[model samples]
Target: MTTETKPLALTVNGRPVGPVDVPEGLMMQDFLHEYLNLTGSRMGCGQGICHACTVIVEGEGGALREMRTCITGAHWFAGRTVVTVEGHARHDAKGEIVLSPVQQAFIEHFAFQCGYCTPGFVTGATVLIDRLKRKPVARAELEQVVTEALDKHICRCTGYVRYHTAVRDLILATPGLVSG
Candidate 1:
């Protein structure tokens, strides 16, 4: 048996990565973990339905969307920009880590236990927040919005209430996330 390799290139975590060779049929999660040593994206169900392998991919229009890395091919991400859980933090002038509001909320709310699904939740919530910023959701519809955004992720430890609450609190705390 022989494995063939193909060229791949993508921007990850605000850094340019690879025009290097990756094994053909390599999943994005493998590329992130094996190739780049980025281990934040966890493999849960391996099916797209679980979404525990989700990562943020920036669209050409600059919109961010959650993608299930376990099922997605590394080649599919060529020329794309991706953000993993490790990339979710903001860096200050001194280059210290500043947690994103969503990440902060998750910590404050005790949103995870084993934390296998936290990366997906964080990425999904980040996308939701970014989307809300562009088109604010009505206060009445905020719960539904949060649900829809995070519905696909599975967290075995937390019953999802904490995650949901974290997302909700982040939305409410952030200006322009919800329409008045």
Candidate 2:
């Protein structure tokens, strides 16, 4: 049987990507890897449980949410704006990789070992940080709140504590995310 292809176009990492033909069954991660050469969103469990293939998608009402590319079809992201792990940082005039606050914190705290799961953790924590920015968490509730937000991401490395602490410290440092 012959595979039929359909147009797949979306904004990825602030760049407009293909309206190019892709197999209708193409997974988002595959599209990012093969079609766009953007592989920051990794391939891990492949069942969406590990969330290693998570990418941030702009959801309804302008909310930023994680979308699992391993189990999600590329077509599902058509016309939407998506942020891969590569999108989290902005480069300066000197043309260097400037890690986002979350990314930088991970390094400062030494968040990962193998780093296969770092992207997912970063994405998860980024989502939590963004959400907290809009609705500050109670200082009393901060720990539980951050834990719940990031607990779902499975890390196969020396990361949970560092990741959690990094995010917590960032939240504490940033004004308006934690209210007494």
Candidate 3:
């Protein structure tokens, strides 16, 4: 018996990745871990419900959408731009890695305990921030907005308060993310 494979091509972390051959039905989580060696997205529940394997995908109108890598097929991402947890940071003039504001806030706030669900949280929070940039949210609605945004992600070891507080504080502090 022969296994069927297809060429997979995509951009990840601002780098163009291959049209390399991949086995059919391979999940994006597996592809990231095995093929690309980018293991930041953890396989928490092997189901989409947990949101632990979420990655940010650039969508129509340049909108950011969170995708569950564990349940998403690798072929679905072909020719698309995907951002894993590793993609959030940039390098400085001295080549030192700089964390995105969300990551920095999470670390400073101790938002995560085990950090298994952190990657998904970061991706989700990023999407929210990006969305707010395009259309700022009202300050009065900020708490509910943060809650709805992160409600889907499950943090088994760590509770949700810290994550919620960190993201909320970050959104509140950022100049244009929230409006009066």
The Cα error of candidate 1 at residue 107, in Å, is: 0.5
Please report, as a residue range, the 10-residue window in candidate 1 with the lowest summed lDDT.
Answer: 150-159
**Per-residue lDDT of candidate 2, residues 9-68 (tens digit):** 889888888789999998999998988888888899999899889999988877899989
Prediction 1 TM-score vs. true? 0.96
TM-score against native, each model: 0.96, 0.96, 0.97
- For model 3, give the 10-residue run with minimal summed lDDT: 154-163
Model 1 error, position 52 (Å): 1.3
Question: In model 3, which runs have C-alpha deviations exceeding 4 angstroms?
Answer: none
Of 1 and 3, the candidate ranking higher by TM-score: 3
Cα lDDT of model 1 by residue, 6-106, tens digit? 99989999999989998889999999999899999999888788888899999968899889999999999999999999998888999989999888999
lDDT-based ranking, best first?
3, 2, 1
User: How high a TM-score does candidate 3 get?
Assistant: 0.97
What residue pairs clash in candidate 3, if any at all?
Answer: none
Number of the candidate with higher TM-score, 2 or 3: 3
Per-residue alpha-carbon lDDT of model 3 for 1-180, expressed as tens digits? 776999999999899999999989999999999999999999989978999999999999999999999999999999999999999999999999999999999999999988889999999999999999999999999999999999999999766999999999999999999998
Q: Which is the leading candidate under TM-score?
A: 3
Candidate 1: deviation at residue 168, Å? 0.6
